[model samples]
Target: MEAQQKIREQPVDLAILDIMMPGMDGLQLLKSIRGSHHFPVLFLSAKSQDHDKILGLELGADDYIAKPFNPLEVVARVNALLRRVHHFDVPAPPPEPEAKQLVLGALTLDLKECVLYVSGEPVMLTSTEYKILKLMMEEPGRVFTRKRIYEAVWEDFYMYEDNSIMVHISNIREKIERDSKKPEYLKTIRGLGYKINAPAEN
Candidate 1:
């Protein structure tokens, strides 16, 4: 109660939670506060099961670290998350007299506002998904290997977890693509990686 009150009173940039908290579990606390706080929350727990990690991510935790982990690794992960959030939070300089938005097909990405629009309709995206989309949009037609995508967006070394990248890509497509099964913008190059291609002008 005291800790929770302190969190409400203070300006918290991030939260590191243990899954085994007394009275209220971390996931419950996460559900309670996530709607109000947009800051990152990382889970540290002894449960190293894959399902545990997936559940944490699904419940809005930014990153999960299992127990028996090195303290330095935890610090590194915290720093990386903070850096990514800060990078996007910083306001860009005023747009040029004639500002240009990145356009790929019906999708438009406003670099200044860090927002995405599909056919002039706003599309909501999680921070991680937005970074991945931004990277691909910035370099249309270029294939981004899974490793490259992971490192660039997560700001961490890729551990060859293809599932993580695939999940985010699917989420992004569901939001922006009219038909995610047959995506027109984001495409997969079998055995190679993924790329974004601008639709040829009519």
Candidate 2:
């Protein structure tokens, strides 16, 4: 508790915790940590069983090393995790499995920068909006079903709700379209969802 309190008081780059502790088992500790913020967690345990390893990963431990592990390997893994945590250490954009942009309709989305430019005009977008746009840009003119859009955006954190997807598309249209009601860029296909064109040039 004392160690955890001190660590929590400041930013934690990474965490190393033993699986079998006295009061709180490793899994319990992991839950406690996740209750607030997410960070890379490395589990070192004497229990080498595959089930234990699987449970550790399912619980959100980033890397798990079993007991009787080589010190050099543990050190190397720890360093690699640290590099990953710090190098690419940020929650991915709301919808992207990775940071990739799909330029469309005279717009460039620097997903890493989280910046969107439409016809060279800076357009601010929420994470949800960026995700919806990203999908449309990836496949120009291909209608994305509402269910698919919801699954792409909100399925990770909540039940698929088309209302949320519709809202995002509406917002994106307002930002990128010359007349959102007429929507020069993102077009709604009556019963289908929406799509954007990858600008005449990439």
* Best-fitting candidate, scored by TM-score: 1
For residues 73-175, write the lDDT of model 2, one tens digit per residue. Answer: 7786676556544322354545655666667657888757556888888775543465667767777888888877755643332333324355556667778
lDDT of 1 by residue, 2-58 (tens): 557877887766789988899888988887665555467789999888887777766
lDDT for each of the candidates?
A: 0.78, 0.67
Residue pairs in collision within model 2:
105-199
Consecutive 10-residue window with the lowest summed lDDT within model 2: 154-163
Give per-model TM-scores: 0.76, 0.47
Where's the lowest-lDDT run of ten residues in candidate 1?
Answer: 86-95
